[model samples]
Target: MTAMRHYWLATAAKTGAVLADLPGLSVPKVKKVIGRYEPATASFPLVGKGVPVDWERILIEGATVFHLLRDNPNDPAHGIPVWGGMLVRPPRTEADDVQLSLQTAEWYFDGRYVGDKKYTGVGQNLIVKDLVESFAAAGPNGGLPIRVEIVNGGDGKPRDREYQNSDDKTLYSVLQELMGVIDGPEWTIGWEWQANPERITPVLYVGDRIGTAKPAWMPSPAAVFEMPGSVLSFTDDRSYGRGKGANVVMAKSSGQGGARPESTPMVAVDDLRPTFEYRFTPSTSIKDVGTLDEHAQAKLQILKDGSPTLEMVALADRGPLLDVDWFIGDDIGYSIGKSSRSRRQPAAIQVDPEGYAPASPVDGEGYGSMAGLTLDTDNYAEPAPDTRPIVPAYPRGREGVARVIGWELEPQGTPTVTPILYAPE
Candidate 1:
């Protein structure tokens, strides 16, 4: 595969008209991030020492939208518009040099709210769809050309839960609170350009599970990365700090007449561990015992089985392609030094593909070197020793599946991605 050229394009936030191509003055200091819990964001420099006059005129805060597209190596005229978002605020500068920040359509939720609404034993997905559609019906200021998709049990049927938003909290916060419910759906604002209409469409995808878990020629599902190969360096910290252990948890919610209702403490005991208790008091808006108990149980579980964190810097263009091979909620398998059964969730990803290229010509080819190897001892040349390394022979440290929660792209000397991982129970 050939390297793809990446560039930014600007357009009108409301009308979506093609405006101008924005290539920064310098090497284009760019950074983009996608999170499971928050809206996606990006930042790039615009005016500097040698910015073109036309580029300078396109810096309208909150009105202009920018897209990061990767051009087809064979057809430069056509490009794949992968990630895009709106300019959330005014450009920042020191001494006349300017930089702009961006946030995806999801950011619009921060301004819209689900005022005076309450749902009792409602499907989580149904609530999400209803809230989003309500905003879209509000016209230009709040309306967006988004298609709502609910899959994997997010259709307001089965898996019922309770939700109440009387204080008029923003849609963003409401969704965050709803999705944080145990076993609730995952979500993302995915984008794609349509040919017939010549426009970019945002897909508000919500589901019980939102990614692929296919066999990747490894002993596990999802893409696998081994040290001394795709993996570069990693850090493992099992210290249960900050989110300390709490075997006993008490949860409380708001009650009638300015009073707060509380739940009996949820306890988990082990003969070998000491007791650590804490109280969890959520927002006053939450006023149901069922909800409070759920929160309490979830907290107690976390405290009982502390989550360890694992992070690593690996080649971005290796193992799997973003969106295609792995998505925001997909599980990724990685081995550091020895293969031990473990699982981690990707809470964040930072990609800095600036000053570096693939270390070897054999990388980024959609498949690893181990993809085609097979056992054919019969065709043997006792002498026909397998040309590939034994699949189990590669050095593997801690090995387990991890869910991708977020991703980032920024400037670094080498093209790499650092994914923040959290051990999941």
Candidate 2:
């Protein structure tokens, strides 16, 4: 029997005066809303109209390993050398969420003397040229490089120690020794170096190289993880037990020499879902127009069959508004297909909302809103809107009203799409 799975993913996009009340907030801060389940008397508001909230625990199960090198100095032939060090990743915990961490390390080796008759064990740490080359090779994509520096903490001045040849075998022995010192079960050894303050402190730096190309050691799929399934419904009650408030009217008159025209309430349809209920407090003072009462709540019924559906809800005194806005250019959609014996092939799909006429056809541009494209192997070309090109008739009535412009469905790989809808102006 095929197991039916349900995944709820909801994104709330808000617009209008409700947003105007907030100032200087980041996009994620202002638009994103997290939901929680609690008792009726809980201080936090409820989500979903007429439905009790339910909670599900999410867990992450993945690991990554990093390799690094350090310095060693005990060998007879080579003075100082680079060796591997420890592997590192974020520490997982039950109560806290784990975020990404950046790690880096550097290598330092002891320098040798050329003309001195007596061999002194004390020597300054010097950075080896190969160490730099190794880091560069490992970070071709410009990942944050571990800063490597050589220093001598011994009483001797910097000029007292002679630099060892790059090929010195003694350097290799020193590196091996350093690795042994830091080796352990939980840690993966990379390069190792001496920690004695007198010998020299090797400098190694690591961090998140934001917006930079990733190094080869980094995970292949850039995203940390992919969430599965679709969301059926969502609600937020933070403002007033479901983001409701009293309606207010604003009026103003303009006059230069004569009486000015009176301002009127903006007339527009306020669409609401019947399955959801909203409640708000009334405010006599204009300042309280958008203010919410201390508590809010909502209820919703989960679909039993659970085929997978996406739901989004926003609560506000002014009513819900479509949060869709194009930051880039016009929205478009495409598809890709691959067979066991060949490479993947991509195809564009056409789409059109029910009432609007098909846009002029372009060479490869799809014809519908970004959300209408169906997940299929056949490619569809997007039609240009300006030219008004003739196209196939769209399904009549409300059935053809909305189309999926772009969609993805991959069981083993990452499938993502940006769905956009247009509102009647």
Candidate 3:
């Protein structure tokens, strides 16, 4: 059965009361939605051309919220809420259509700053929660319809940390600066929908990782994507650009009178190659000593491996079909058949359980055939030298366990998803 896309225009309040269940005619003209976990954000375009004239008022910037859900044909009322956020910009009217832009809930923190805020010693999550709460509890004009929640205490990291920044900096920027410190926590503004009670809550999750560590909730078998079947195509990128990609990062921050303070450099030799070092500098807004260390540690975590990223075009929807449903931060395994050519034909098939989904044959020899192929063949028949390309190494061993950093879904026809992946620590 094919899935349906649903859009809702609701009041931008904590209750999130639905103001309108948009009809097909009033829905956005475009169906593409993109979501990211880090710097948690989403983007989609909405047009007023086809929308009902009366609904135009609700499209007013900063007045209403937007939600996109993928509904199963069997249960339309209760659907998988994919992306929910506020309008990022004002409407743009061209010819006859008014174009509107929407972003995820995290955009609320984009302009919010932690001006003149000083802290001697405080937990990072607590500091973040306190800042977010100030916005949540603000006047109606300045408040956001969200609540902060810590899923994991950053793997029980120290709480007595210092953060004192006088320069005007967005709350999101502060979080980024702090999280960039090695071993710091990551946060996201995600949606939670309860069918029976009919409640949708915007939750801010901060911790070691999104769904891992203490108070764990999201748990399932690791998602698997293989070529010749699920994966349509993929690109593996490995970079060693100076400063951009490095195994060693020296955290630096500005001191009084523009003086720069330096911290112990953090190193993680992920690449077997010679040491690649880069000096990490936090924004001038960050003035604390400990915060500088955090930024360096975090920068090292990403630069440590030369910032390896994988982009895969998957031939599947993100629904529950074939148990392929996945969230933003889920650990997934994707393997390209071309990369496993050097391994014995059967060993490659065993590596991916779905079957022998070979990308191409070597010397007109197909790996899918089981006829006259046996374990003994690998032992006795291999007197000839194998010239196949060796399988390239992935982040987590040969199976290539990776985290889903972000994804884009095109649900209009022949639903497809393009997933952005990165190596996880």
Instruction: Identify the leading candidate in terms of TM-score.
Output: 1
- True lDDT of residue 79, candidate 2: 23
The sequence of per-residue lDDT tens digits that candidate 1 reaches over residues 311-352 is 777776665655555666677777655322222121121223
* Per-candidate local distance difference test: 0.58, 0.21, 0.55
What's the CA error at residue 3 for candidate 1, in Å? 2.9
Residue 11, candidate 2: C-alpha displacement in angstroms:
34
Badly placed stretches (over 4 Å) of model 1 are: 25-57, 72-78, 92-96, 118-121, 136-140, 154-166, 213-218, 255-258, 338-396, 411-413
> Arrange candidates by TM-score, highest first: which order?
1, 3, 2
Best by lDDT: 1
Taking the tens digit of each residue's C-alpha lDDT, what string does model 3 give over 217-291? 533235667664567767766667876578777777666544777767777744245878787566665556666
lDDT of 2 by residue, 1-425 (tens): 22211111111110000101111111111110101001110011123342222211111111111111111124422123221111123345553233323121221122221121212333212222233334322333432223443322222212121223342423323232222111100111122223332121223321111012224464221211111112122211112123222122222222333343322332222222122233222111112111111111111111111112221221211121111211111221111111122222334334444332223222222232334334344553343454331212221100111112111111111222222222111
Evaluation by lDDT, superior candidate among 1 and 3: 1
Candidate 2 residue runs with Cα over 4 Å from true position:
1-224, 227-279, 282-348, 351-425
